[model samples]
Target: MGESRERLWTRDFVLLTVCNLLLFLTVQMQTPTFPAYVKEAYQANDFVVSLVISLFSLAAVIARVFTGEALKTKSSKILAIVALGFVAIFSAGYYWAGSIVFFLLLRILVGIGFGMGSTTFPTIVSNVIPAKRIGEGMGYFGLSTSLAMALGPLIGLGLLNWFGFGSMLIVLVLLVAIIFPLMHFIRAYNQLPVSSGNAQTVTGIRRFYDKKLLLPAGLNFCLSITYGGILSFLALYGKEAHIENVGWFFLANALAMVLIRPFSGKLYDRKGHIAVLPPGAIFVGISLLLLSLTTTESLLLVSAAFYGLGYGMIQPSIQAWMVKVVTPEQRGMANGLFFNSIDLGIAVGSVLLGVIATHSSYSVMYRWSAACLLLFLIVYFLSQLAAAKAKKAAVASENVGV
Candidate 1:
């Protein structure tokens, strides 16, 4: 067990990670780029543009709510492939969308596919990795996502600048399509044998969702809400701040994530969530506060570094913790709940902040985001304290032969 845990790298693991990276690259590229495209193409206002973007998250939340139950009937790879097909089809439809209304509908289709595919990839990867080293392995796997976040929008904007919106859409479509062949290269693990105890549990909606994941997922939702603000407005804010390019903020954030994820994951596996999450949350809050005050390029990049470190450390640790608490059969549900909450957060944040920014300013908007993170920190510690007490009571009852 010890030896297997340390042997983190394997062929399937590499392939799955690469597959996830490619998928995320396509998703990330669309995030910032699409909103700009919608605004320019349709002369839409910030509220309208934000609604179009947040619509994807809303669709994703709806899709993920049922995706866990769907996984129970199908293999993760099978579900992922079908979902990828959804992304591929809608990506091309972007070229034909003549109006914002039509484009919003297409975005919903893409979101459904994306939510299902993203959830399954993590579920499959978690099962392939050594159980003891799950945190460490997920850390490495998450780099694919972090790197995509760094470069996807940059790539999207570059394509738009060099070619046009149609060409950019083609590139995104191609990226989603590339995963089809790559999926064949991956050798997925066999299904784990379900114990009778698990098999006998009542089948219902509750069975399809993991309640154990709520605390970490809720905390993740808080952080991602702030992330939604960055996604929705950083480019506009950069222009407002007189910075030449604001995309570099994501580049800086991704770099910091790349630097810190491995170490943070190892720390979680060794010392548990207490060793990582609280500090990570604080870092994210500070980053948001700094971003609120960004008057210089250097300060902007510094804020990115803080955001990267905080998100990179906290996100994977939450995922690792989600997987840790559930049985193998329940991983699908846990992952679905985890990602659904994240998308919901981003969706709510985008719409709510759009209203706030309209009424106030982007700077004020980010300060509110920072406040949300600080609130998350307090909530997280309280949850942790409750969990510790519950755990202690469980041990005591076990000693009493419950």
Candidate 2:
């Protein structure tokens, strides 16, 4: 009976995880394919092609601000459904978008729909998973997004190459439409409002940005910068390094993530972020160093596994930390900021590392990218120091009063 309550694979949890997976698949499938489609179909230059990617992400990041607030109340059932349906509608509209302007507008609308749905799904999951198993539950759920990230682009590009852009849109619409039916049967959204406490008092913009989220979000941001570099430049790096079938890196990385996530989560559950973060950061930094000099496909995949293992450890730990620190009602906001940091970091990393690559080599760029994690380590340790100092001071104050 005790084990039953501790269960992480309840029906609704699985349903919500699937729903999250499909929605993210819908988004990520577009990530790599859209830039190509826009350049070819519209004969767009670099700036316009860039907009095809950035605007959707920027809009999605912005949209989460409002959607996160709405989710602070009753769970995001209605918001998510409406937003997802809105996404499907806009997605289908892509077939008829006459100009690049029209297509970009459609992308923003879809991004909003995506933003709303993304925030709601995690908030619902946070509410549903057993308190003791939040780390494990979120780790399992995080796999959906990670897997989609790994698979969606491959699938999207295949659909684009084998079929065409229009067919891909149709498939995407149908995929999202399936989520609507699934939502009806899902009963996992049990988030009650933060009825009392400081949560009730905070209003307007302040309510949306919780200070407690800053350190975790910042660390997540730093980690994402390296990922952004990978997403934006790994293929180019493959070219530079003269490695054939560089795609194997992602394959190995995905495999490593699947293997490592559960153990990382369990470690985090038992020993907190300290157990997970330091070693995870070391693995990632070492992975980047290895990738910098990777000359063979075998070495490339080995580097990927290290990266996957480190990332699998850190990301869920940060997310679970954010969820644990917040009140139940604030989970949506926490999740929103969590995702937004990733997007923002990715954007920044691409631009920052691109400049470095322009001046130096891809190998050098990767070296600099590893330095982001060094910053991650420095910031993490400093925060720990500050927290310890605060705790010591509080203890001394109590002793003095006694």
Candidate 3:
């Protein structure tokens, strides 16, 4: 009975994780490669290159609104299938992209599909996970995403170099296509809790965006901004710095993420975000600083390890914190909003950092990325102080009445 009460590794959860892993793997593989591709193929500038990531991300943010609403009462099966359809079809469409504009269009359409798939998988998993272990389960679930982010670029750049862009797209297309059959095994699609978010009295824009999720969502946004810079320019930066095997940064980062994720997730569950976030942010900030100043492969990889450690700790804490604050019904919106923050951050970071790189250098741009996290720390501490004051006031009021 006790085992069942805390079961975090059910079949449903595993399948969801795999589907999400594949979905994101396909997406992240393109993240670092596309900028270089757009530059070479289209003779594009930094602004146009920024559009490749930002515009696609904004489209996904808008699409997730509909996805969140649909998941409230509709069949998650239908949403998942439609999302897969968009991905498989549009991914193959990349082969026909004769111009950069056309390719950006494809990215927009596919991101909508991504928004649907990304939201549905988490909503279903949030239900199936034993409520007692939401942090651990989500941390494990998050591994699928972090791992994809970690390894996809190394594989993507390899495919681009060894074969060609066309062959790389073909591989990613097949990778995405594989997810279709796996959907049949997901049995938790229809099992929703009775106390869903729809029961709350939220109205208008608030219906889709919850106030409770704002602070963590903001912090998550800042964390993703640093990564956004990495995704948009690391490949290009490799050339700028004359580094031959920059993919090693991602490989080394992946190793660190793999080692740290389990322990960080358990720490969040036992001690809360206080035990995890600040130190993790410090690791991320230091990594970006070191990466900016690094001139050799050894130093580059050391920076990657620091990043992986911080990112491993911080990302899951923000995600689990959002999930814990909302109702079962609102989990759809929570997940949607959670992802929206990430995509939006990526979008903003890509453009902002792209401009910095245009005028200065990628190294300078990374320093700016590190500085953005200062906003994260400031927002987090302010929220904590407010909560503490509110708690103190409540206690004082109760004592006077007594």
Candidate 4:
């Protein structure tokens, strides 16, 4: 029976994994290209380009808050399908966008679909996987995004070279179209039994925000702020620095993340977050700082390696930590909150960093990123101290009882 259960669980995980990969591929296919498209179409300035990058994140943040509520009342499978349909429609629209305004508008609409679809996968994963394996599973699950991050843009660029931007957009649309049919397989994964009680009840909603979970969520926010800067402006920075083969930097980062994720997941499962998080944080900080100082392409690739390692490790650790502290029934909402925090950070970072870049040099942006990382480190240590104190108190209480 145990073996049978394991097999069933594995099957479910596989299905969810495939779905995540497809969704991430759709996301990545456009992410790196969108800014270039906007720049070319609108002759946009820094602020406008930042807006183009941030619009999706802002919309996703707003959508993430409410997506949890919808998850409770509706079939997540259908919601996912609807979201993918939006992605397909909006992606196709890119081909026909006559003005920068139309492009930006479609990007915002894409964010809405992205928000809904992105949130559902993790929620489904949490439901299907066992509690003990959640961290490991989520770590493995994140590789889907990492993989897409690595390949999607390269593929997009390749398509662009061969066929043009319109053709690349068409390919993305077609890829997105595949997701609707894939929803059938995903339905089985979502069918894992949910708790009988109403998740919408006041008490249930209150329980979703575990104080212990907030530490990781906060960390997620900070980490994403740093990442958002990279994602939104790396291409621009590369241009400023006169770095050739800028796409390789992204590729290197994604490849490093893909290589490191499984190990990081296992480390998180075995060693706890304390063992995994700080080194990763330090590496990330150093990477960003180094990126700020670099003029050469070689150094930029070095920064990518460092950043990728740090980001790959930190992301899964925080995600695992967030889900680990929550109850089974509240996992969806918890995941919702987790993702929303990320969106919030990304949205803010993209907009603010854009403003900063406009006013100053790109190098200053990295300096600011370093400062954010420092702040994150401080918060992380404080959380560790608080956890230690709580542990000591629990030990004392046990001793007293004895």
Candidate 5:
């Protein structure tokens, strides 16, 4: 009976999860603080600071395009190791970046490593888990990022205050270095079948991008724009507002996401997007709106909680939806495309919203972000309605033929 049962936990899975956690920790640790670093270090303006953040996403997007296409031919294990090496190397480069141009170059390199590593790791997880439990497994896999998000910035900020920026860089380098040895233990990398999609026949850009995954990807893209605003500017916002405990926003956000994630995936597996997307999007919208109005520490915390719950529910649900809808062969591409959308959103959000904040105020920028989420709801519903119509038409034709 035990042998007959599907396994969710394995040594490889655990190691990969830890590796993912470490990788994301390196990324998240700098999310709220990198702009500050560029500002203090280079005396960059808001546009320049936002560019630093956006460049990472842009590089990640470009890297994923190739990463997705290479999944079929590349050894994911090797890819992961190499990517981690780049991450560690560039992470240390932070200490040497004396100019804005040099720092931007390092950020791009870091994103490239991160892009390849992120794609490879998730594909490896998909291979290791029971096919029937993709949602649950991915949800659990996602916990690494969630936990990192919760803890990374808090740790980064603390280190910055207690020690210095150089200390933070050293710690990120160490975190990436720790994962290097662990990658050797992951047995699932070469064991599982690559996605069923035919990579050889599809040449050029089509090989890297998948259109089928667009809906959820689009939704994720929209939501992540708001998230970019939070990640890139929230610390600055707190400083401007005279709020001392701005970190609480991320704390509340991360905790809520962790609490909801375990079950949110299960909900998606059982009931589909209707059970998750609309409610999740609504929560996200509300959170952005709340953030716009936050004048007190308590209000900021409340906005954080709402944003956490909203983002937590929507992100995994969209991911699971992307996986479920695609053929096993397409999982790599789907994952790549899905994540590409997320990075694209972050890139666009950081640049666009950064401009808005420059011209207007952060409060105005957040309110506009909240308004954009309302458009997410509209897009989601329209997509669902169109999908429903297509399904009904197909069903009617089938019945008539029968």
Candidate 6:
């Protein structure tokens, strides 16, 4: 039992979690502040602000694919450090971005850094944690991101209100700087063992296109799309709706995730994806529907809780499932494909939802989001059926041999 506990609480896990938390916090801190900044600095419209937000994902998708390939030969520690350093530098530039074009250039640079670091961290975690505890460790690691998403905007907006954008940028810079030193602690844990003889050559990108990977990858894509709408438009929607204390929505959401994730991770480890995933998807669907109907702050807060619980539960479940479906040699590419799916969802959701909001109401965006969830639910159930059938067939083949 001591050994079991120690497996979960390694130095590498702690260091990686801290690094992920700090890096993600920098990104989250800017989410709300950047739109406001673009609006104020360049006198931009909603479409332009949306573009500013979506551009990050656009760059991240391309970078994630390349970064995944690079990890086959490169050091995750060096890549992660360089990525964080770039974030710190470019985030600091938010202070001096006088025009929209310059601000966008800086945002793109930040995206590149973000894509590289984010992809590398998961790959590193896969290396450090014992194979048996991958799901549990990944769940804990993912909480850093969930917590940042929950808190960063609230803190960022408070700082922005008190000290303005320049001060907010400084805080982001400081947060990212913390990762530079902390990264060294993770270096030893980051190295994967080299194969004997020549390094095995990977073939074309088609290696990433495994059929077993498609189910979890599709789930990730849809899940991210659900969140992208909420993250990109929720604040603006709240302001337009005249809801008071909008930050509390994010706070409530974060608190729910913090409360749920550790237990969910343990549950995933003890049970399996089938036990945890269906409920998570259902909760997310309900939350999106609730979000569509909410007008009061109370209803919105409740929606946030539902959404957070669903998001916190489902994301790790999908990741655990993805990792389990691939060989160790292919884990990096699988993770890359998984992250790319997420980026694709976020990119498409932000742009398409932004267009929808431009033409209709923000509430309409949530309603459409509800429809998307219905589609996700159908696909999820079908996939589960297909997996069950395949498992049964394999078992039957073995029984016949017996």
Candidate 3: C-alpha RMSD to true structure equals 2.5
Report lDDT (Cα) of residue 11, candidate 6.
Answer: 81
The list of candidate 2 runs beyond 4 A from truth reads 1-4, 190-199
Q: Candidate 6, residues 201-291: lDDT per residue as tens digits?
A: 6587665556788888988898888777876788788878788676677788888888788778778878887777778878888888888
TM-score of 6: 0.89
Ranking by TM-score: 2, 3, 1, 5, 6, 4
Q: Assess each prediction's global lDDT (C-alpha) against the native.
A: 0.85, 0.90, 0.87, 0.79, 0.84, 0.80
Pairs that collide in candidate 6 are none
* Model 2, span 1-402: residue lDDT tens: 988879889888999999999999998889989998989899999999999888999888988888888887644788888889878999999999999999999999998898888888888888888888888889999999888888888899999999999899998998898898888888765545444455466787788888999999999999999999998999999999999888888878888888888898888888899999999999999999999999999899989999999999999999999999988777888999999999999999999999999999999999999999899999999999999999999999999999
For model 3, residues 205-324, the per-residue Cα lDDT tens digits are 887978889899999999999988987788788888888888788778878887788888888888899889999999999999998998889999999999999988998778888988
Q: Give the CA lDDT, 0 to 100, for residue 103 in model 2.
A: 95
Question: Model 3, poorest ten-residue lDDT window?
Answer: 193-202
User: Which of 2 and 6 is the better model by TM-score?
Assistant: 2
Top candidate, metric TM-score: 2
Displacement of residue 253 (Cα, Å) in model 1 is: 0.6
TM-scores for every candidate against the unseen true structure: 0.91, 0.97, 0.91, 0.87, 0.90, 0.89
**lDDT value for model 6:** 0.80
Better of 2 and 4 by lDDT: 2
Q: Model 4 off-target regions past 4 Å?
A: 4-9, 39-49, 96-103, 193-200, 203-210, 239-242, 351-360, 394-402
Total backbone collisions, model 4: 0
- Candidate 1 stretches with Cα past 4 Å from truth are 1-6, 40-48, 98-100, 189-199, 354-360, 393-402
Q: Once all C-alphas are superposed, what RMSD does model 6 give against the true structure?
A: 3.0
Backbone clashes (count) for model 2: 0
